[model samples]
Target chain A: MNWIVNNGDLIGQLVVAHLATAIPPIILSFFLSIPIGWFANRFQVSRGILLTVFALLYAIPSLPLFIVLPLIIGTGLRDPINVVIALTIYGIALMARSTADGLASVDPDVRQAATAVGYSARSSFWRVELPLAGPVLLAGIRVVAVSTISLTTVGAVLGIDSLGALFTDGYQRNIPSEILTGIVVTIALALAVDFLIVRIGRLLMPWSRIVGAGGGRSARRQRTAATA
Target chain B: MNFLIQAFAFIFDPKHYGTANGIEVRLGQHLLISFEVLVIAALIAIPVGYLIGHTGRGRAFAIGFSGGVRALPTLGFMILIALGVGIGLGAPIVALVVLAIPSILAGAYSGFEAVDRRTVDSARAMGMNELQIVAKVEVPLGLPLLIGGLRAASLQVIATATLADYVGGGGLGRFIFAGVQTQDYPQMLAGSILVIFLAIASEILFSIIQRLVVPAGVTAGRPKDVRVKSSRSRAALG
Candidate 1:
């Protein structure tokens, strides 16, 4: 009660700042990792190593990355740039592995058929493989998006003025609502972004849903059985 | 060069070995917090996941809940609960339990869901009761997936529990927070290193458990029914 009315402006600023820090990495990593994913999937020699690297990167604790990023990238400890860079790297690590896995799952027959249909390698990938890979890739992206949203708040530890500032401020000021607002808003933002990505994936590949619906009960069962 | 030297010294200091501020004390805190959270999460999530997956009615709930939990920012959640519940270890444990539940739930239910329908049917024909069938058939078959979920959930608890420092719940994160405040990069690095070691060690520990628990047939090279399961805690080969 007192937290919101008195700190309404502060919450608003934090939300905006939080979104600002969170979005760039999500967008950047999507573009950045697709190529990296493709390269990993295409090359037989380095697939294992590449994936292992990403997995290790993914496993690195977020707090350390947040702390260590400034030293690696030559930014101030509290700089939002440090947060963004660290997050972008984390996002890339997450997205690249999924991208590789997605691309790897595309049917060889479908790929050959695409090539046989007078498509160049470039066109075949963009038109054929990429679309085929969308559902899995988008599924991975949903996790990453949700993950990034959650992780972005970790940056506030280093003094980035994101929604995490609310946590710090609330704790400092002894205000529960401020902290509550931060939690609700952060979850809402994550859900909204995840929903948007899912919708966009659906729009991008209407045929998948049609195929899924047409495939009948067991195929759908298998889909549900795949786990998160 | 300086970073390496200082970080090594920071980690290896003798006085810091068994003191209140020692890495061992913090690591113990880390393990205790993670263990409590993982136990609580498994109890709730595994049962719920098994029931829903066994019944096959709560797929939507399971899926939606998994996504929703991932989206929950831990720091805010921790602080929010801490403010409401008041500080101590309790708030961080509650927050970590929230963070850990989804994958565990997904794993438990999906394990049951993935069991062969024919096997269950054959067991029914053999005059086995529902309890007997689940206890005998489903439990063994679904153990791998359950272990996988436990694997992910445990690591998540270990990784995320570091945030406990923010809410005054001490762990390795204390070093991280303290180091940052005082510009003690070596201490910060040491803390982060210890955390990473624990996380990786836990990962290896669980995978080994999974290998031992999962049967030879299930873990064997059966590429049939390949599906992408990008659960938050997917295991990776190092």
Candidate 2:
């Protein structure tokens, strides 16, 4: 652990860089996917095409995407933003599927009930549909958060700097401790972020917490199945 | 667009196709590593997953383990293993196998888990042995989901196998890494394209297999079910 102690400041900086690189894509993808997901859900005709495209997008390896993205977007080869943009694309691809599935999971009868109560399309969506879709959306976002956080390290290969920098540096220097630290920290950060998302979800959707508390195994199964 | 042309040119150049480090050779290496890792991981994981799914005995542990595995950074794993083992196929193979195991395990068991319990009960009612039931009932019913798991595992392995080059475990990733050092954007892009092509080819191959494997009567609902569950692996896709 002397490596960590001697490199405390460097570790701190890398952690910050990692978060900066990871969080934007997580947040951006979560918000952007909701609408795209809604469109897919709203227009049944487009659902298949949209999902297939996103799935293909996700299937592209991150390194190649990182290499080719600059060509498409004109970022410099080593630009940190290239990593961010590529990750956002992946996050959207993933979250869009989740969002569409989340939005689709809403009960039609409940939506009709909201309409009968005089909620407009927009109002009902924000109020009735979005809230009802919260559990699945939350699950989707959690996955996005974890995966994006883990993926931010790929930027290190390109010399863009992040927690992943430790990996390359450690490998070059033959410092296993540093690589271990990066792996542990990355996983910790992901799980911690996931925990924070869950906490925030509980706070924002108090009713879900209540259902979670009372609904027992069946509700839990339904949630898993929804995301499934 | 210019780089795209350069990349295609790099890919098509006959001069780049045959030597020790040729695209074809690296591509073959890439596929070989991925195939070996997948086969080994499947051999290990599928049975454990099957037990978990069949008995419902370790579902929670399986989920927790896979979820945690998903959170791991592939680059970190590769670097660490390569350092530990002094750089060889052992490192990449070990790392990639670890990466492949979770999805396959998830698939094998979840495939069994997804089977209707009532069907198992009926099979039992018919005096079928556990092995016979699994073979005739659970395996047949769960083939699509099992295949879905394999497909996801294959994609992630193929994609990450590119990184195998990072640690001297050579693959198509050689082009990407070699190009990066020389600033040969075309080579890097070409490597990426080749990997993407492999991923897509496997995807199509699996989808067709997934379709063909479904027991005839259950075809209507199983494909869609498999599609939705395909989301499980994206968490580990990175």
Best by lDDT: 2
Label model 1 with its docking quality class.
Answer: medium
> How many residue-pair clashes does candidate 1 contain?
0
Model 2: colliding residue pairs: none
Query: What is the DockQ for all candidates, taken in turn?
Result: 0.56, 0.64
All candidates: interface RMSD: 3.2, 2.8
Pick out the ten consecutive residues of candidate 2 chain B with the lowest summed lDDT.
Answer: B225-234
Candidate 1: where are CA atoms >4 Å away?
Answer: A43-46, A206-228, B216-238
Estimate, for each residue in B92-111, the C-alpha lDDT of model 1 and write its tens digit: 99989988888888777777
DockQ of 1: 0.56
Model 2 residue B177 CA deviation (Å) reads: 0.9
lDDT of 2 by residue, B168-229 (tens): 99999899899989988888899989999999998989999988998877853376812334
